[model samples]
Target: MAEWVHDLGGSRGFGPVEVEPGEPPFHADWERRVFGMTATVMAQGRANGSEFRHAIERMDPGWYLASPYYEHWLTGLATLLVEKGVVDREELEAHGAPSFPISRAAARADVPPGAQADPFAVGQRVRVRSFEPRGHTRCPGYVRGHRGTVVRRDGDHTVPDVEAHSEERPAEPTYSVAFDATELWGSEAEPGATVHVDLWHRYLEAVE
Candidate 1:
């Protein structure tokens, strides 16, 4: 059997979960370390010194839930590396086996603005444009093609898909958009329900 470590929220303490020996660890590569480091830097940059820690504390509330741990690690690592420039798109591709450029000369004409471009504001109405979905997609399975309004837009950041695979193209800027739960789930959904997700600018279109 394999043992996993977990933190109990609110100063309770850390504990272990036992699993079958052949079972895979949640974070096979344990990439969360990189993610945590990057998050810490970003938090400090935004004057939210304890933001990352606070998020972690809120997420783990005693009882353990089964989830794809490595996915979380990958998500966090991709975000941090791109944010801190520890792993650029070109570098990631180089690290991958037999690297090849994913972008064409036309697409490589210029560098796109990322987090350093401009600040995002709230109450912006946006629509997600349709695109060929491939690799890992952040555009949640449930919200595809669904019309919604942006309640809040978090600071700009690099898209994580390219980073996760080390694609040759540079990381594109992404925005955190919030949608009304009713809009996505329809009239049957709770009146005040809502869901927030990070989406790259390329994935959205401004709808009047």
Candidate 2:
């Protein structure tokens, strides 16, 4: 599927960003509750950060746009809680969560074999793979199929693309890929502008 307008990418257009001269951390009491609950649930280990983000990414396009930022967070967090059997829709809709345990499978799942390779080095030219993912993916919509230079090797870490789907932990090296603004935004982009995106090894291919 093509990336939606809501997806973080070059194609997504935003009206002028609103500036808050002095913004409070949260706008309202409910927003605070939503933020706090999401944090507490993730901290309790009922869901990992990757899974929560994926849930948010998978939200319906209409709902995603129609809701406020914190509402989206609440929606994703609630969905994970129910899906993990921590709470049911009735309880969740009632604005109450029953007792829930941290997922042992998530903390102790065995790492996938042969997932620690670190072949690419800094300053290497690589292209983001053009894969339309049906599952949770770390690759951003903007950088797919674009070539960029590996500006930094961010060391190896657990791959979230797989972890979002299951308890399995697969590790891989990550890098910061720097792309010229023109390459992504066209010649109209200001000269000397660029964008840096952190990408995992699986998202990149060596440029010969």
Best prediction by lDDT: 2
Top candidate on TM-score is 2
Model 1 segments more than 4 A misplaced: 1-121, 167-171
Ten contiguous residues with the weakest lDDT in model 1: 1-10
lDDT per residue for candidate 2 within 16-132, as digits (tens), equals 677888988888999998888988997888889888877776677767777778877887887787777887777864655453221122222222233344568889899987777
TM-score of 1: 0.41
User: How many steric overlaps are in each model, in order?
Assistant: 1, 0
Total residue pair clashes for candidate 2 = 0
lDDT of 1 by residue, 74-134 (tens): 4344434444566676776676535422221111112122334233345667776544333
